[model samples]
Target chain A: MTASGTPASTGPASVPHLDVDPFDMAFFADPYPTHQRLREAGPVVYLDRWNVYGVARYAEVHAVLNDPATFCSSRGVGLSDFKKETPWRPPSLILEADPPAHTRTRAVLSKVLSPTVMKQVRDRFAAAAEERVDALLDQRSFDAITDLAEAYPLSIFPDALGLKPEGREHLIPYASVVFNAFGPPNELRQQAIARSSPHQAYVAEQCQRDNLAPGGFGACIHAQADAGAITATEAPLLVRSLLSAGLDTTVNGIGAAVYCLARFPEQWQRLRDDLTLARNAFEEAVRFESPVQTFFRTTTREVELSGATIGEGEKVLMFLAAANRDPRRWDQPDSYDITRRTSGHVGFGSGIHMCVGQLVARLEGEVMLTALARRIARIEITGEPKRRFNNTLRGLDSLPVTITPA
Target chain B: MPAITFIHPDGKSEHVETSGGESVMQAATRHGLDGILAECGGNAMCATCHVYVDESWLARLPAVAGDEDALLDGTAAERLPNSRLSCQINITPELDGLVLKLPERQV
Candidate 1:
């Protein structure tokens, strides 16, 4: 029974309806107010226009992400339900799948991304990070988004994937389009589609074994196919999965940290005192300003959370950014304190389908932030940071920053 | 500080000082004892921190509850009788010399 004593299985007519357009520019730029409204509206609020259910509270969003069997991600974790509409492209081998298929694919990807493998790649990442930091520090004034956040990942991740440097510019827009397409086909989605075709072709061509370097993540995934862990055709799609989900999140995450540090310079000072705090600082920033903010999960069966009941196959939106700052789950939620034990914040998500490349993302963050802390004594925002909106991802369009060398 | 030993998939082991309140996964990550991803950063959500508790230390730790039990099913390595998510096991005085054998990989 709900706190309000509403029957758990009440139909759409009796449900509390919210008419907010979460995809609009206003909501995308500043969503906390709407998120608060959604959370206060009820545990389960019906979005009348979208014909979907929305949950912004931490407990509800975390619970839904964990109980994948009840709230399925296989049907597409986007506004459009995969069951009702045909997929725009072949679904991600890992992201858009469920067990036992998910089980097999996840096992393969996880092992490939496990710490054992990730360790060998770190020193290389750190060295590149230090080099990038030195360059940025020398310049002192640069757009953190394009100069570092975008440039760093674009250079390193593709090299790690054994992607040829030629046509590498496609990674950012390719990922942007992929993430943007997750929402309704609004102007943003339409624009992304128009800009994405060439980049998508480059990514597709790069996924082939001969096109990839022999020892990269792409080739490692193909080796699994040779071992009969997955099919030959499935190999390229898995590489495509890494390209789609990995790079953009890391770019935005680093961007978020730069933005956070610029806003909260004291946190940056704490990092200067102790460089070990890089990963912790990054984790806290993710908690404070989540990059991949929201995802949709389709209900597999009738379910009641808090008070609202959602029927099977209906889209349920989980506001991850909202969950990260839910006052019920956090103390002084808006403040970004590096000391906060920010793990389990749903920033990298939770449960079976968590971000497969989170470790890599954290590694990138640690490298960049730690490198900066070692050299830069202070940070100043030379101009206002601009917001880049997508249906699911939160990132900066550009952040102009000037650093003072230690 | 009480120290813990982490054994990687290749059977390599390293001992690192473990803080009283931190989880075993934190000790490993802090000291750069690779193989423990702790991807969710010690959150019970990701089973990447899965390890086989030393038979001697198994019963001394708290019984697995919550999401740890379910997440075990997602590990890339085979789940054994002494299997546990290290993140669920907080370091303490009684468990000073905790030994955890990380799986071949965490799914």
Candidate 2:
């Protein structure tokens, strides 16, 4: 399409448009080849399938994320604009919010998940990792996704949130549905919405202040409301934010780390050589496998980016997975080297909207990898890996691996 | 451009020049100086970019506000009265020759 609202003062330029559906299952299965083409197409390319602008290159994506005022997050971080279409659930106080409201909620959540609190949970999380690794050593082969990736977070995260034991099974489904809903109104989104009632009910019930056990993250959030830091009405929504954002992301993140290590034996060896590299190894996996792949930002006004002028109120789909692997930003962008400098990767996103629960995720990843690094001599892929296709997340459904004890 | 000095825990110092509007953490990381991780990329969410503003220059720097205040409590280094997240301090003409002491470690 011709650049529609170009001002007379600026030179006429055609916006690069592509015939691709990013939300399609085929594209989700292997997005990198398409991602490379998108990156090469331009800094900003219009996706004809979704009728939205797509940003694939690192420089543009980083700039868009950083300038939240210009490319706002409030209008639903998905295809459906919150202003135009009603949200399926109450908007997340922090994730879907901009400043002022966001600043207040973020302060409370950040305090709850601060480094000091992480320090307190460190020993207990480490003990849990050690216990799980001890049990896994007995099995010759196992599904990393089910046994290690899913099981570890399922065990620890809920307890940390003080969620009751009975309805814990709904956490993953709830998170999966929440993440999938971020995409278009495709079958995946429809099916997830249709099946989301029970999971939604359970998550909402668990988020209540009375339902949560004392001296936990959930309780801490409610306490923040009690102390006048946030309103009582906002407390449960913040907990809902955590439940929605936390579990499945970490599960896939751990799965991605294990899958990457299993594929790259040399990188695994490096971690084994220097146990200190456990954190770096997990981080590199995040950079290489960017699990929470894409997020949408709405342009607050007419914007000029990469010589294309995007009209006001247009949705710009950020290819976070593509940016993480963009050759312009990363050296050997496709390789899974554990020792690479992974600090700025947008896997956890960037700017003020960066993942609030990242420290918790990092602690989990580092602890699990360290536990395995200490005992496992090698990680061998024994069977075909099953891919879990989703609109927003890139992860595995099952990864069969056999571990050798050191 | 404003010149800034980053003094490591060992007392060794590195001097760098940064353009206006960039944060001290941005300058350090851009110059490839060690210690300031800036994990949150200047959002002040992570305290890995903690630094102790040199006593002489502390009063001149802008006061800490918002997330930077809460995050200072979580720094790997001890939070001194003069402590700051380098990401919060923007470089300017008046702040030339700013001195910042790097912490012992940044986790």
Candidate 3:
């Protein structure tokens, strides 16, 4: 055993075991059961075939996320250890590094993504959300995911990041692959890799300084590099961070919000009654059905968890969705309640590496939620919602709904 | 009111009255002390509020947690061993004479 009491073996028998396969259909259809099983199994449960330790309990997940020194991010946050294989394109400059290096790069990008600067594009985002929702309202029967959720972000985020219209098509598939790559190289990763090839060049081209719009965040990151705050090479990857995180997460978040509101009509009416509740509704949805399901971190040293020992260099997967539903942290954990205080949940993650683009996400949700509250008197699912398959993110492929006009 | 001194990047010191319950970042921002930006709103998500704790007060302050230390890795300014996010440092009677050196920039 190592100093902290974790077994030093790299073999299958050394790690604590778990029963759930994250990519399985049942877990995908409803992950809470698997979450409960993992949490009940142990604080750090190892999956034999996947060869990773999983942390499903709320407290353990929180601890792992906050203690990056013990559980580092440099080995690539994905399931395939970066040390063993090179990443397909390149690792996200922001998501792939630990501090000192991560700090300098994050600083440059944060300035470009500052709340004041993001405010500049808020109205355009709101208008785009309204236009898309209105187009669906005219039909009165549309897939909430394809028609509204995907349509809205696809319309706004890329343009805001300074990509041209033709390049917009590549946004979703590329981002899906990136997030999927964070998981084991299962059928999901294979499928995403196959579909994502066509858009790689367009995504890479948009990373160039000349290709970005003059005043957008992407160009601004390059400007910071020019000013000696960051290197020119770091600029594109930082822009890629925005592109990679911007689209899929928000789309799933918004989709989750719609699913919750429709599932609980009383909550939708509450939002309609007071527009301020729009923000609360969106945030609560994140707490209710976390979009980015799970992310991994490598233990830098032997660390003691609730009852298990996580060895040095061992991988730990934090189930954000499971943690969000953890009974230890929330009252009636399964119920979707907007009024409940949810700000502390790890939906956007916790600790230093928490989502930098959260404000951008909130702004997007607020705009869409407000527009729907204003235009639609009531909404209910007309058909069973279809789930979009991904190893790490839970999103809708289609949510057919009937919209009653306000 | 306890007076907290913030030594700016330019070597200027600004004193502000801080409430017992508020964090150092909250007090500085509330009093318009320049050079500190708590961008994540004190959630420890962003390292914008980084400051070097004065050596005199280091022994009195609680040790930084593993999570906070990990976050300190990504600050724009070079991190000294005494570095802490001002948001995590709450003011109290024991910390009345606390002093922090503000970094040159907040990303």
Candidate 4:
């Protein structure tokens, strides 16, 4: 579509073009290898097929995330042409916006989801996490991903957001589609779209203020609208942001942390010995294995990064996962070490648009992991783990683990 | 342990003894000082725990980096020149008797 042979627009000569085959199963199974290759090949690789420039290195990725003026989010962060596809529902008022609009929406939601306000739900979330872990540990053997990790967030986040129990079943699959839609339309997107159709109405209904529980975050958002902090029209879209971002991300993060601990029993022992490491352990896990792999930003103008040029309006995929592991930034990047004072990691993203729900996510991980470490003597993998297929979310399908109680 | 005083927006001052290794925000949080809310658990991601250091003791604190500076722009209240995210400031003996003015709101 452009002079650089990428689908979007003409990029400068230094930008290396990479044509990513959306259908590649190996790429799907393990994208890290491809990410590594892209990182090594060049700092800015323009994918001709996907019509996007890929920034795999840490510095460039960080730069793109920080400089929102140069790399805008308004053209739609997802691969879909929002003008054409127009989204089955409205775009996320938070995620899909560029500044000024994003600034206002984020300011409103930030207050609603503030840590002080969130503290009200902290004990409830911790108790729920403890209960879920207790139930799973009682079974002795369970799929860590589905039973503990996924179950905990699904049980806690939705109820906290005030979605009805029956209608709430659609949250995960719907969220999976929303994340997958960030990438190119492939079999994965097709599959998710096919699966999500049945629950579309249920999902839409939950976004309405009337459907939200009184005093929950969703209701608070509508209240903010009523108070003129945000427009009434933006209320459901904000609720959609919470629903879309809240659960699956935390599920993957918690699962990844547990998987890392199980793989490294020494780390598990350390956590068991001192439960305070539970918080840092999650941060370390995110640093080691980032759950949200990549998010694309459309370059607003020609920007120079890592001795290369990224053209205007070109989709730049910031490989946060690869960046977290880049040897340029980290020492012993691959090891799962909880004590490794891991701050500044891009797992929750970077710059102004980082994950707003990260506090809640950290609380969930800390509570459950602390509970597990306190009660369980050891965690061992009883069977091979299964990986969930999503273009964006790097998560587990099943992680069979045996918990030996202390 | 290091001693630190937090000056609330209401001009109320509270002093608390904090462990050397704990972040100022954490010490305030552990003491249940109504002000500092370290939302991201001291990852320096969120700017909830905003405070203005007493100008005389400002030079004693570490220089604010670009990241912290950018986050300060998002603070809930009007940010003073010495505005710092309390999470980024760890408790040290050098910071003993350090006075910080808490903002009216974290969000």
- Top candidate, metric TM-score: 2
- Candidate 3 lDDT, A181-258, residue by residue in tens: 888878888778777877777778898998899877788889998899888888888888888888899999999999
Best by DockQ: 2
A1-406: candidate 2 lDDT, tens digit per residue = 2476446643223567899999998898888899999999988888888889999999999999999988998999989899999998888889999997788998899899987788789888989999889879988689999999999988799999999889888999999999999999999999999999999999989999999999989999999998999999899999998899989999999999999999988888999999878887888888899989999999899888878888789999999999999999998999998867677889999988889998898889999999999999999998999999888988999999899999
lDDT value, residue A340 of candidate 4: 74
Over the stretch A1-406, how does candidate 1's per-residue lDDT look in tens digits? 5996657558565567999988989998788899899888877788987888888889998899888898988899888788888877778878988888898888778767765566689899999998998889779999999999998887789988888778887888889989988887788887987877798899999999998898899889999999999999999999999999889999999999989988988888888999878887898888898999889998899777776667778899889999889998888999999877565689888888888788789889989999989988988998978899888889999899888999
Error of 3 at B1 (Å): 17
Model 1 residue A122 CA deviation in Å: 1.1
Candidate 1 vs 2: which has more DockQ: 2
What DockQ score does model 1 reach against the true complex?
Answer: 0.16
lDDT of 4: 0.81
lDDT of 1 by residue, B1-107 (tens): 88888877787888889777888887877776666767586645457778998898888899888457766765658889899888888888888788888888653
Better of 2 and 3 by TM-score: 2
Reference contact recovery of candidate 2: 0.44
> Relative to the true structure, how large is the alpha-carbon lDDT of every model?
0.84, 0.89, 0.82, 0.81
Docking class of 2: medium
Score every model by TM-score.
Answer: 0.83, 0.94, 0.81, 0.81
DockQ of each: 0.16, 0.55, 0.09, 0.09
Residue B33, model 1, lDDT: 63
